[model samples]
Target: MRIVIAEDAVLLRAGLVRLLTEAGHEVVADVDTAEGLLKAVEQHEPDFALVDVRLPPTFTDEGIRAAVLVRSQHPRIAVLVLSQYVEERYAAELIASRRDGLGYLLKDRVADVDQFLESVGTVGAGGTVLDPEVVSQLLVRSRHRQDLELLSPREHEVLGLMAQGLSNASIAANLFLTESSVEKHIRSVFTKLGLAHEDGGNRRVRAVLRYLGYPDPGPGHPSSAHPSHQEFRP
Candidate 1:
């Protein structure tokens, strides 16, 4: 895959470039600042962009903001954010626009070279990949929400895997169940969450994440009304 990297740290930036290069992926452009990252994306139009959540100047959320801009302007270019800390808000915002072709991984994950490369390839192919830490954080926040209470213990397990962008096959393997059984659990999850089951696209992904409050409701998109605890049938 052709890639663009945005990292403020010199050693980390060089390491990423070397890693990708050795892995046979082309590093089309590498930049240290968020502004430069945006310009590099606009110029190279790489298939994937590996960004850090913190960048130069403020060093708060510049990389994330630039990533959002890339998604808005270059929808086809996938973004994978590598951060030192698992900031739930940043993860939520990154996945808010669309679930597919997005990733948020903690910096420590890079040590697992094989898995890290796999994640990059997955996101490059229009898949979602969230750090296990991020998934845990989102799950904790959602657990107290009224809608999430509708899920059974098993269903909650399935939902957590779903939020990790795992396919039914993967969730089935991890949970020691048949793929069909996983599908059934997913359907039940969608029903309990009041999300429509569509024949195609990432509807399930969107539903699970949105229910966890990842998708910020923009203008004209009112927030979903959480059903009363008594109203939950599941």
Candidate 2:
């Protein structure tokens, strides 16, 4: 797969290039600044990009903004972000857009080279991969809802898979269940969460997003389980 990398750190940037290059994948462009990163993306049009959360000019969310811009302008480009910390707000911004092919992970995940490559491949294939840490944080924030507390452990596992943006088949494969059973579990989950919506094509994704308090607020859009009038703080 062809890739563009946007990271501020010199060592990590070089290491990622070496790793991808050694693994037989092409690293089309590796740049330090967010502007240069976007330029490289525009010029080379790589299949996927691995971006860091922080970059030059302002070491605060410059790369994140660029990634969002890429997703908006080039809907086809898969983008994975590696950040020092998992911010629910950032995840909400990414998921708010209707398109897929997105990932947000903690920086430490880089230590597991093989697994990291696997995630890169998954997102590049139009899948969404969220860090388990991010998932946990979202869940904790959503726990105030009595409906969420009612989910059985197995059903909760299904919800997590849904949040990762996996389809029924993929979730079934991951959970070692038949696709039919996964569908059944999903139906039950929607019922339990009181999130039944025929218009929302991907109810599972919407459910997970709502459960995480990032509803779309449209016909099929997610409604706030937690209202927008409320402010969530760290």
Candidate 3:
């Protein structure tokens, strides 16, 4: 697939190009600024694009803003956003577009090359890919919502770790429980949240995002160092 990358960090940009190329996908274009990145997409019409959450000028939401614009102008092109830290507000804005070929993952996740590649392929195939951390953030903020208030503490813990992008094994390790127990907690959380039963996949992300009041940003805005609610980020 032809992919465009928009990231301000030169080293990481080059590293991504090299990695994707080695994995046999074409890196059609790479740019450091959101404007240049958007222009490249307009020119190249790549199959998908990887955008950073922050870019030039404000260094805040420029890249994300660009992605939103792209979604409006080019619905067929997929986008996967990378961020040092994700905000529920930003996630809401992106998802609000109603575009399916989207992803929002933390930058640290890039270190897991295989998983990163899988995410790339996933979006390229028109699937949504959300970082578990983003999912966790959504769930925490939603707890205040009347529908989610009844979750047991154990179920809440499972949901939080799941949002952190932990596998059942990892969740089990963190909670000092068996993998089967972890699965049980997940099922309980799912049922309590009134989510449909399926393979789950990115639906979990979407449900949690809606629950957290993403586009609205809930109560107050907090820096990455401090989140308004603890359940969302842990």
Highest lDDT against the true fold, candidate? 1
Candidate 2: how many backbone clashes? 1
Pick out the ten consecutive residues of candidate 2 with the lowest summed lDDT.
Answer: 225-234
After superposing candidate 2, which stretches have Cα over 4 Å from the reference? 144-234
Task: List candidate 1 stretches off by more than 4 Å.
Answer: 147-234
**Candidate lDDT values, in order:** 0.82, 0.81, 0.79
What stretches of model 3 exceed 4 Å from their correct place? 145-234
With a 3 Å backbone cut-off (N, CA, C), the pairs that clash in candidate 2 are 216-222
| Cα lDDT of model 2 by residue, 10-115, tens digit | 9999999999899888999999988998899999999999999889897987888899998999999999989998877776677677447999999999899999
lDDT of 2 at 121: 85
Query: Which pairs of residues collide in candidate 3?
Result: 132-163, 133-163, 137-232
C-alpha RMSD between model 1 and the true structure: 15.8
**Cα-based TM-score, every candidate:** 0.63, 0.61, 0.63
